[model samples]
Target: MKSSTRSLGARNAVLAVVLAIAGLAAQPAAAEERAKDLFGAEKLPTATAPQSFGFYSKGCFAGGVAIPMDGPTWQVMRPSRNRRWGHPAMIATIEQLSRDAAADGWPGLLIGDIAQPRGGPMLTGHASHQIGLDADIWLTPMPDRTMTRAQRETMSATLMVDEKTHLVKDALWTPRHTALLKRAASYPQVERILVNPGIKKKLCDTVKGDRTWLRKIRPFWGHDYHFHMRIGCQPGSPTCKAQEATPDDDGCGKPLAWWFTQEPWRPNKNPDAPKARDVMTMANLPKECRAVLDAPGPASAEAATYHGGAVPVAVAAPEPEAPSLPATTASGTAGLPSAVNAFTATPEVGVPVPRPRPPAK
Candidate 1:
């Protein structure tokens, strides 16, 4: 009887070990799940209060708002990408820049990618637009007429840099282009404006008088067709990481010349290696990111869209005294007739029309 009891006890212990192994196998491992796939699948922003958690390349955000496909001074390109979303402050800044850029004599803005619905690593393109503060504005001016949705998707942006010489194509460069960059850099909230190295060289050689703002224009790869505008972290998000400040002097010196050399252009040594986005799992992101991913989203994309005037002023840093710029021809929405002006007319979708005001008591 003692021998039989000992044999039964050993069999039970073996069964327990087998069950433990099976349980672990049944559960999905967080390490095996790629963050890009999880974040890329999100289609809408959380309805919670806006907060950015983590670095621009390795974080996520909540309470995102989408810029309308068509605005008075701007039209969002690549509408199908569903990337027009950003923090309320970021959306407001873009709208404000559009108005300011128009006043500075450039045509309407052809807006590029802002961020995915919930800012996180994307399925493709960009390493830093993950936190809803980075935006890409095309070099090509908005055409005179409103573009069709199909056209916006198919349109090609004009390349401003010559690949062989690494220089701005002289014919395409204009004073208005310079004015647009100046207008963007003038805003205090704008921390950095990234452009092609060639474009940086062009600005360094030509800009006169107030060269102070040129300090913010950074030289980077692949900005030949568009310039990237990046704003600093805003008021409520304590978790948002701030980038290092640019040097005080105008960057027209040896740093700008380095891009002309062959070393910077050398091909990647490990082309087959995986990108950080490809391998990043939920474990790699901030602890808050999991909660952000699980949070509830708005009913529709339109429900969370920014329609102007409600943005908190605190989101932006105080504006510095305005810089002096050359006077240019008046051509933005301000001059457009009310009948044709998009600002006055109702947008086709995603933006609610304003209700008639009650008569004053």
Candidate 2:
């Protein structure tokens, strides 16, 4: 029996290697190139139509707008990442949240990764945030003065979790943190807020009554220093997809208990773990993304006009030209941001959806 099993395993291993080789042989060079560098692309495609396509991770965005690095109530934390770009609705929401944070105390807010200028998979770090709807806000309080660009790039987020106990480090964590979490959760447009399990536990223990907002404060891995905020599809873009809704429970009981158990921390026993993230191909993306990559650079003046003082204005900084495509209709551009200008030449294909007003207070 043992010999027979060994022979079967050997044959399977040989077959797997052959299949892997065949897969690579079949993929076109364009697909391979996309997997390597599309995510790391620095320049926004020439087209300035603000839109998101497909699901967040498997999708892309075009004509993305930049969130100002320094606002009245917030400072973007990581400038080098060049991830301050997002859909206009997301940008407006962040600005609103920053002011809300200031009203609650703590020297305004410290913001982190928004998305690449045209959203797609990141060059490194994070499997999500491909769409402009996700952002990271540091738990660390922003200082009352303007920070240098260098400071923004190098600063580390203040850790809140205890390594051994997997709980809030009692000394460093404070009630102010709880207050901030509450404020973020209260925003009507926000769909979910991801934090370390420790932070969720802290909320579970301290809060007295009325746990309605707690349902949105989801516990996820590796959010000790900052919380991740996600919004549903922007109103204007019909093709934007929403993630499945969270369960009805607050997630502080059985769901929370699972994270603390030995099972989650154990090494993967299955030798056949699926595949690495780097293996994703252009085929893995929505068909429209090819157009996103091929779209021409905007005219110099038009580019500058769109960016303005919103960001550093690298609009005229000389980007590599994308290879041209046979003319295709703008129908594929159905889902994206509102036009940069009501008069600019971006394709005017679909009607943008209007956002619903908040419930009466």
Candidate 3:
């Protein structure tokens, strides 16, 4: 019996490996087609359109949806220029989450924000939260669990929606918020997740016993306020590459194979320590949240050791040199912010900006 069981396990492992290779073999044209489709659309404005949809041949749809929550339905921020039409599978997931919430008699399952870009280029600047595929969801009690006021505060802080505009305020995590997050890890579309160090530790602990699915995902340092959820998006592909849940790098620099077998999730605490807050211009923030009277975003995720209590990150300046003003040129002024403008022969797409509004009382 033992020999037969061992053989069966070996066969299953082989099958899994074979399937993975086969999947890779089939990704090129599909990936190319996806790239073409993604880039072929209209010149992406600085951002994407509101709630566009993307459909993958493999049966996934991802885009914007306003899910009803405690008060109003949550509205996500979309890029002003480009929007990936969502696939059906993603749509079904949203519908099912709403249905499950309703049937379960919950207040509301608010999908506060999606695809709020924390970092990365090409898709950076102008508007990141603009990507329709990303989402920031509020942490709700597990259907079988209860939520406390502290948990609510943690959720509220973690959710960090602009009370006035209801877009993702920012992404950050704390110890309390981390516990709540482990409960939400079962969603199928989740690819890589970012969180505070303490939260990652708790996740490592909580899933130690049996959350095998957690193994398929990785974690990173998230800015305070919200957790960044990375989802898969590829239209016409039989399978989503980024969608396969995988093991985390255990940024703590330890092997985590025994993580599921351990008692409590013990994530690295040092790297997750809160750093001094960075000052951002109101112009850089989502327009809706600009109304926040005191918009100091949560503490930073990295620390600087100058030893002053929470000092602002210093900007290094160029070394002083003998000053020589630019020699006057015949027809141009030097060293002024360039007044560069693009003049397309045809009509061009312009990025949409949120009109500023008063802060919520």
Candidate 4:
């Protein structure tokens, strides 16, 4: 009886250990998977009417069009990022920017992430761009030669700001960059342009006259490498929300000076100074987005779908690898729309966390 009791006790202990292991593993899949994590799992854009819904950070897009990989004057960067999708108006704006840049005697534009197809909170990289109305133009000029797929993946954007002085670096700064920015700002459709305060200062100090476009280029954090361009809402989409108008003045005075001071960059005194952006769920978004998220699409779609009788090609610079896995904290906390299942199924590994994208400046 004693021997039988010992054997039974050991069996029960083994069973308990197995159950504990199972429970521990299960926690990552369910508890850690938030709604934002699901955005990447959606391989296709919402196939309903073409519309952008909710504000920039909490919305989704339907019938998104892909900006093609190579345009006459623009080429995309980071093909594996799968962020080339945008509203058609936004795409057209980029196309125009490319043409304008060339006309200004500047190299072609090296475009960065615009929005994911079926944009919602992204797995990484942005708080906005959720509704497909924003884009990033690399400060680095597109090379005169056609970029190889591998070169596009590996090349780094030029940093324009100097670290010690918090000002523009002379070596990397140029008048043509100012010309490109002025061109982007001149577009009436543009709501704003976000750049490092240093870049804004350079513009304010250097541009000879006609400061009108300066109002559109507002100062923001961490955009020394690229300028973020946001346009007004798509013309007919009432669901789309327009950001507040840029203030009346050119914003080159006190407002611009404030960014270079200690206040903006001062370390948060709050012991818990870093707070996450408001957690977004489908519940927090427009009701129409529910159908957008669940909508079906063409199997061959590359973030583009058949909409309004045209199949816009989803353009990406060739990628050496597949899209990355959902980013996780050191403690294994995952950012969401469907962090769990997507992470589980992702073929790629060790995806770098994208730099934290600040909300609109």
Candidate 5:
């Protein structure tokens, strides 16, 4: 009887070992999971306090808020991508810009991608929007009528730059265009406004009077259809990494001249190499990001959407005072071209307009 019992106990131990190995084999290694795939799968923002971690290209953010798809002065493009989410300050800034741009004679704003709901490496396109501080505003003006979901996706943005000459097409360029960019650069929170090299050169050649605000307009590639606006790190995110400041001088000299050279447009020698997003795994991001991934999200996207007024103070710090402008342009009207109308009326729209939210008690 004792011999028989010993044999049965040995068999049970071997079975236990076999089961443990099977369990290990069933789970994929964390290091092998790509960060983009993990972040791209998220559909909503975390309900906790907002904070950004790591650099703009190599970070993640929590407590994101989505701007409504259809705002009174702006309409989000690419609705199917579900990329309108951003930090509360970013959303507020965009909303403010749209209203301000309208006052400056631009019809309305057609916003491009902001960031994924959670703000991390995307599955496709963009390398720096991971931190929720960057946004793309199409140079194309919002149409007079509300765009259908299908129209928003299919509409193509106007290309302002000539491919061969790398110059802004003179026919499409207008004084109002320059005024719009000027208004955008006036905000203190906006640290950088990246545009096509051609657009930068045009501004350098034409902008007269005080050119101080031109310091914030950066020249980069692939901005023919839209311009990129990047805000500085906010107060609540202790871990948020800030980008280097632009030089004090307007960047219209030697640096802007380089984009005109063939060196920048040269064909890639090794196009087959994988992009950083393709290989980045969870191990590559900040340790805090792991917790952000696991944090519970809101019940729906609407629950986390911004409805105007100030974002929670815990998430969005108070807006800094705008830098003082020259007395001549302090009213934001002195410099506009004669063609611009200060009081352009809002056109009729088919979409439902969002009602103003009551003031917080």
Candidate 6:
């Protein structure tokens, strides 16, 4: 009986050890699988990874540290060839700016024309900029380049200037380009704005690092031509990690001294000018400008600020209908015959002159 009891006890201990080993082995596999699901393993074939990769942990747009995507296990799926769409919050902000521009008769902002879209897995391991909210606006002057005249006019009107200077033109410091920069500074979703050398100088001088408003703007490489705008990660994304509010020298993954100048341009006398010449925020905006964007196409006089003396066209009233006679009255009048006066009576108009249908082909 003692020998049998010993054998049973030893068998139970062996089984317990085997179960513990199995549990330990299963843990890592489960963790790795979860990581793979979070970050896709492979690069998306057609998509490029995001550029100017930096992150923040606190502040407006970015909530905090982003969970990393595991490239080793997470496989990327090919995205469709449909039109590129941006994050809803980012789009909403851009649209507000555009509407404001149109209302002020400043034309529209050329966002996508020269803007860089965030890349995705198809290209390779996705980088920090992969989230759709980021964009890069070129800092170069608005020369003829390849853009159409209308495009140049539109971009320039929104404080984006492109001139052909012997020296490399910096967009951020130019007085003409201040509107967009200032407006961007006002948006809460923007965590950091990386610009070329000249742009940093301009921003520092313009706002004087009392950077109270410019707190989110940071300096980085690519000074020769374009300025990078980093959009904060939207809610629910795992990869977002916000960096410290102040700038740091950590691996921002940037080029060295690529920009040309450290000097700032002279400050414009009108640093405090409203976003557009005409419209302020809806509350302060002139009543006439408020109605301009809704008027379909551009406004005539009140809408077009360029025309010096043009007055706002009064909102046109709906045309009145020709007086319709009751059937009884019509019969009586016809029977009387003499009731009509040839000289004083008007001819029956078939249809109210169709307001000329505003000229068409």
lDDT of 2 by residue, 128-176 (tens): 7876788999999998889999998887889999867889988887778
How high is the lDDT of residue 246 in model 3? 52
Give each prediction's root-mean-square deviation over alpha carbons: 13.5, 7.8, 23.9, 12.2, 13.6, 24.3
Highest-TM-score candidate: 1
Quote each prediction's TM-score.
Answer: 0.79, 0.76, 0.34, 0.74, 0.78, 0.36
What is candidate 2's local distance difference test score?
0.70
10 residues in a row with least lDDT, candidate 4:
338-347
lDDT against the true structure, per candidate, is: 0.80, 0.70, 0.33, 0.73, 0.80, 0.33
1-361 per-residue lDDT for model 3 (tens digits) = 9999999999999999999999999786344422222222323111111112211111112112222222222222232322222222232344444444444444334344432211111222222233234444444323333444344334443343333332233353233344334433455554446543444454555445555545533543342344555445422222222333354444333543333333334555686663211222223323222111111111221111111111223221223332221222224433211111111111232222222222345
Cα displacement (angstroms), candidate 4, residue 188, comes to 0.9
- Native-referenced Cα lDDT, model 1: 0.80
Candidate 5 lDDT, 297-353, residue by residue in tens? 666776677766644312212234322211123244443221221111113411122
Query: Candidate 4 regions off by >4 Å?
Result: 1-33, 270-278, 302-361
Among all windows of 10 consecutive residues in model 1, the one with the lowest summed lDDT is 336-345
- The alpha-carbon deviation from the true structure for residue 353 of candidate 5, after best TM-score superposition, in angstroms, is 27
In candidate 3, residue 7 scores what lDDT?
100
lDDT of 4 at 40: 73
The reply for model 1, stretches above 4 Å from the true place, is 1-31, 311-361
lDDT digits (tens) for residues 115-234 of candidate 4 = 887788877777888888899999998888888889989998888898778799988887899899999988877879999989999998988779878888899988989999998776
lDDT value for candidate 4? Answer: 0.73
What's the distance in Å from true for residue 73, model 3? 8.4
